[model samples]
Target: MKFATTLSLLLLLSSILVCTMSTPLSRRHSLSVIRKLNREGPFVGLITVYAPEENAFLASNAFKPDPRHPFVDLSGRRFRIGKVRGKGVVYVRCGVGLRNAVAATQQMLDLFNVSGVIHFGIAGSLENSLRTGYVSIPKQFAQTGLWEWLKANGTVGPEYFAHLDIGSYNVPEGEGINQLGHIGYSAEEFYSESGVPNVPRRVVWANVSQNWYNIATKLEGMELERCLNSTVCLPQVPKVVIGQRGSTANIFVDNSAYRDFLSKTLGVSLAEMESASVIMTSVANGFPVIVIRGLSDAAGGQDGPNSARALGPLAALNTAKVVIRFIELLPSHKKYQDLK
Candidate 1:
């Protein structure tokens, strides 16, 4: 009886161990683990917000999916945007913020067996030089609870983080293709009015120039200044800048506390509704992501001729071009093209 009882206990213990091992650490993290299980090579996933305005931007060009591309579900969940060969990168529009971003990212990881993820979307500028039409890559990301949480759960730790070993995709000396980036926060507010001047350390930031034009024009007299400003399309752009961009969930332009939060925490030049969620989720998932935003409004200003709704698509189009440029220069894609 003792032997039989002992044997039964051992079997039960073994079953429990198996179950524990099978269970994922967090509900949100299962996608990464599943991705690890189905390893192939060189496939990258792109995430964007799924808004009607954003779709309008994408409508200008319908990027096709690669039949051989593993993640092209055709269910609209995942679509392919042509094959760059050896590098089978795909573009997908996941909804906005943390919850949507997390779901979209995981879906990409699980569905396509992609090797990495890249994010292309609009971000308000946080630097002066980064006008409405310019673009910025975030070198170091900043935020509140989001960053802290990602450090605890992601490949990049609390001190600072990045998933890929990104090097310059150099075009030439004083030339076209460059590895530009910046340090900015994905925050939850817009327009810092705490009376504390929100200033950013000298870090290069990227943002689309046209969007900057939209907002800067709202600043009392900026409307006329834009026509005379050529920096709007400067020849040599920096990796980043602090523009007139700040963001918030609610568009309460009268809130003093919210503005202070933007100044103190985000150091925002322009205000928008997304970025923080994207950075948090991307970092957590261990995906090598890039943020490309177009300035649709100047910091602490009203909407000009183009509202967020109108400007989103144009920004997406410009950003898409940049994404394509990066893909073209990728080593895998280059080699694949050479064979052809």
Candidate 2:
């Protein structure tokens, strides 16, 4: 009787172990099934917004959340997978700044097979030519935090810089400071070292996809809001303009002198916190990306403090309208049939 009881206990323990191992397998299978379902329908386009104000505009005016499709990623990032004018889209409000933009973009690419990405939001005008509520599409996007080391002195520059490696596609070597070199001075030997810093740094420029650029040109005459409200209004009617360079950095620029410098040095029409990172990530991943920005504030000078508050809503609305039109212009799902 004692031997029989011991054998029964051993059998029960073996059954428990098997069940434990199978539990994880079952969970994995369930996750796989969920991901498969998400990808089964059609190629989805991604639209990202960095702020709640912009998100509010998008939710109300542009894309509608599909009750049938709600998704939250492993990182707890919630997404509204839905349709805009019958096109599949995923809308994510990635919080402000470069890190948030990059992380959210990477997560989306990992989770979904997105056909393209479009980022639209408010930006400060770097050039006087642009004013609040004017929508501008970037011909090229660049990051602007790099500094050049002054070889004459050990000090790093006031010289802003950015670099792109050779052989990258769709990257234009823009006019200012475009050269190939190492990060810091490197010499074959101590004797070969130039007394000055020989460190190679190229000004990096990431261009919008040519196909998207062509599409933007077609939107040239679209009307934009010039008024803050019926009571307060812009001096002139605003219009959508295409093909200007834009720069991005974490810094909220409020100085007039620095704004002028950026305009001249980078040929930048608008400055913002997130677009360059989004463009860079999309380019590296071989995904097409476009950025449409509405000028909310003139970077410093007279129109600085109240510009974003006064013009932000109008700017966001203008950008959303353009994004909607762009979505409409996208070719049928048949073009993306093979993507599935």
Candidate 3:
């Protein structure tokens, strides 16, 4: 009886061990384990915000998924690993919003040995010269959404936070791209860095990698799709415009008054929800970044002027094409120069 009982206990213990080994860990635990092992990366990171935006990368043999581990699931985000244009890449969907962008980009950086980051997405044109389907690779990015929300009286705020009049504003009905504004938007205040304490840093513009910017400039004359389908075409042929300015915030801007204010006051050519945060995160992590944006609308409150819903996909595809080409131009050596 004793022998039989001991054998039964041993079998039960073995079964429990097998079950524990077979069961997957919680997402957080999985992330911790991956972070500890750190085996997944060292590839260029391709980040997209919307599904349609990533679909472009997907459609080109869908980026030819990485044979080893095609997808890595982290909580809700699924990062796709693959090769695009013959260069290794880890693509991830960055959900909309400033926080989401920061989280996704940081996660990608943390999870991989990201040589550099290339972000492609759609934006609303603050410049009339940039039409739908036109791609703009901004020279730098500003996080304009970090406003002081000053009182109606505009009394007390940070000295650097420019006071924006919330009321009526205007610009020429239709005009070319205006120059960048001299006004000060709020700069991010960091209290400490590199183990130094009691030091504050104010960073306003996050510049793009000079190398990437130069490569993007070469694509100025590249052809882009101007139509979603046969019957639906843009007003003009699509082309690339390099070296403009873009800004990001949590706000979804549709008001012409606000749009013109941002354009004339800040010289913002393209406005979107994610670029600044992505750039900031990359900068913090010592990674080089390049942003490619396609103009989907004019950010005008008027019905016909705001065609983002219709043109978003077309714009996304145009930017994705530019991203792929940009990738082709990247040095095969992963140790690309980072932004200073």
Candidate 4:
């Protein structure tokens, strides 16, 4: 009797999901459903990369018992609130780096189908103004089409609503912001153990170089499309920034060339394992992108200190709070309804 009743309820919810996702959905309708009861609040996605042994993700309290579905395999897992500000708002822990970030973003889109994605995590500020505790919301990103996609429709993707500056940058006053170019995306195994020839900091430099090359190619493609369309702005060149990033791989950090390049050519702020991937995924999907990093370790130098590990979580939490506030300040859809 009890088993039958539970099964019935599961079947009902499954039917609902199927119906909701059946049509060639509209972005506004998607947002309406996502923010339905919670329309009074902001509809957002909070994603986190769960670094090994970090266990920082478990700190969130948004986990709610979700009815398990074969299509959605979060079986035994519960939805935890990575962080919540108010209505239509929720956060998810999407493991670490490109793969994890992409998967998490996809899941959030498929499940809740929110209007915006606010990736709140820590990055190593390669530059100075983006200090140990400071947060960064880089406007533009560089990526490879092989691993991901970049938005070219000029309009928001079919699944999202806002097409607000998807690719651009506004480096905080003084952080070598002028020197910025295109943000880079690197996957695991991006560099080798032994530094490359002519490049003692092979690991760091390789990741940075590869990321820039990949992004340049992607941007060139977008520029080509714009020219064909004959838009007013024939080409849009993104200002890229070199920053410190946190990286996680089997190999140890042993290259100095990355630092040399950073000091000499790029003055980057931080480096981490997953940021490039995150930026690529967000931009491709037409979602607003922000790379927030907590200083973990200084690359190519003596293993600085374990302090970054402790400080990273706090930094991520701070970033989360700021994102929520920013959403609050954005002009609500109500303001655009009649005007649009």
Top model number, lDDT: 3
Quote the lDDT for 337 in model 2: 34
Q: What lDDT tens digits, residue by residue, belong to model 3 across residues 29-117?
A: 65654554345445789888988887766775638786756777885888887788777788899899889898999898877767889
How well is each residue in 137-233 modelled by candidate 4, as lDDT tens digits? 4433322211123343333344321112313323353343333233233322232223353443212222223322232232211111111123322
The RMSD of every model to the true structure, in order and in angstroms, is 16.5, 11.1, 8.2, 19.3
lDDT of 4: 0.42
Candidate 4's displacement at residue 146, Å, is 9.1
Worst 10 residues of 3 by lDDT: 173-182
Of the two candidates 1 and 3, the one with more favorable lDDT, higher being better, is 3
Order of all candidates by TM-score, from best down to worst?
A: 3, 2, 1, 4
What candidate 3 gets wrong by more than 4 Å, as runs, is: 1-41, 156-158, 168-185, 190-198, 301-305, 334-340
Q: How close to the true structure is residue 102 of candidate 1, measured as C-alpha lDDT? A: 56
Alpha-carbon lDDT of model 2:
0.69
**By lDDT, is 2 or 3 better?**
3
Which portions of model 2 show Cα errors greater than 4 Å?
A: 1-37, 148-203, 303-306, 336-340
Ranking by lDDT: 3, 2, 1, 4
Pick the winner on lDDT between candidates 1 and 2.
2
**Cα lDDT over the full model 3:** 0.78
lDDT for residue 325 in candidate 2, whole number 0-100: 85
Q: Which prediction has the highest TM-score against the true structure?
A: 3
Model 4 RMSD vs true structure: 19.3
